[model samples]
Target: MAARPVSGAGAIRVGIGGWTFEPWRGTFYPDKWPHKRELEYASRQLTAIEVNGTYYSGFKPETFAGWAKVAPDDFVFALKASRFCTNRKVLADAGESIARFTGQGIVELGDKLGPILWQFMATKKFDAVDFAAFLKLLPASQDGVRLRHAVQVRHESFAVPEFVALCRDAGVAIVYAQSDDYPAIADISGDLVYARLETAVEDEPAGYSPVELDRWADAARVWAAGGQPDGLASVSDPAPVMPRDTFVFMISGAKVRNPAAAQALIARL
Candidate 1:
């Protein structure tokens, strides 16, 4: 099928972090296929989605292929860069695993491959040596020019200004998160701003609610109107990470609201 023309030229392309769970919230198919109807509904409603489930590893290619076939061409996939890559729990060589993981569902998404998320474990404390070593390994080979690589550090120490600057200089975005534990990285550079609002309620982690979607959409509007570095070059023509676009993601909370949260975001976007 031919790719469809995206309407409303200036509207932001919003996304949910992954999975839509309305159809099978409490009971999901473990062995067989998951919530196909729910996912299809989400795809039609939202511009894109980030596949957070793939972080577990061992996701089948056929499964990914099926999803690709269903979602629209304008749709995108921003995947969490696997536990083996981000989690301090998994100390195994991430360099090799990243290559393998992306080789499957991630890189194969071709143009569909969106942002590669690197969310550090919340409990892991900062170690300058470890952080620098990890940074060194990133730039060498993460993805092609089409993909946006981002890092989401969730730690008290990562709240430091220096660490945030380091990430900026490294050409990696310091993800702005809404959490009580850590202060967000101050926006010093305009390269690209990656903001994640985990819950609809300001003080809760209940995923994206209707009220949350309204606020989120307003933010996306602001983001598109105010072009950043990648969004604007030479101070004349303006663009987004994608031509004439802005990237905003509202994901589900830790309470498995990912699917539901995505559903809410898709409707507003």
Candidate 2:
């Protein structure tokens, strides 16, 4: 019944974006693995997983609770905020949508819940006033469980000091997403660091070369110790010396080989 020591001394979790890809069934899961047991198998292998299902639809509290029961006690699940909350024309008008999304049984995950990812569309540009209002709408807690939030902005306009300061002041992390198509900003706005790696190539058996994985492992350690990984693009100064938790996920690119990439990173760590 006790919360699992996910970050015992300091928290660092390596994982894939989601668990339901059909391609992963035979390669990541056993060829004949029961569909019902996918979470059980995956959670045992990876410390954390990003739940993308919630982005498309609302799930019942029992569904969330069932997920908590299937995974190991040490495992963590990061839920993606629903499209109704993030995919809106006006950020300020999304208050009710955000409330409904957060209220829809997410608290049931309880101790197993890690971070809530709010991914904005690539077309959405920086609007300081509107963005600040939206950030303020993010609740500090839901059903008594404290919540950690990460914003994944896809546009290049977000690469600015104002956005960085806004996230820093609000205590929410601006996700460091790695992709040739998106702006790579590694700013340490909050104590927690969340990264999404999208550079995996299918030709590489591990999705990433050993050299790249080693570099990522080393970067994870640096972020865990409250420092910055040199040579990375940034908008803010390096984080102060203090302990922090880092959540890294291998996403997109070689989607089928994501699990392998996650495990490889964990092995290096």
Model 1 C-alpha lDDT per residue in residues 1-269, reported as the tens digit of each score: 11122443334556566655543355332334456566765676667776788778757777767777778777776777778877764333566766676666455566666667777877877776667656656643434534456777766676555665556556665565655565554342234556665544434333655665677656555544543333211212222233234556665345354444545554555
Please provide, for model 2 over 76-146, each residue's C-alpha lDDT reduced to its tens digit, 9 standing for 90 to 100: 99999999888887898899989998898889888899989999999999999999999999999998889
Clashing pairs in 1: 20-259, 21-259
In the order shown, what is each candidate's alpha-carbon RMSD? 6.8, 2.5
Q: Mark the regions of model 2 whose C-alpha exceeds 4 Å error after superposition.
A: 1-9
Best by TM-score: 2
lDDT at 237, model 1? 24
Instruction: Score every model by TM-score.
Output: 0.69, 0.95
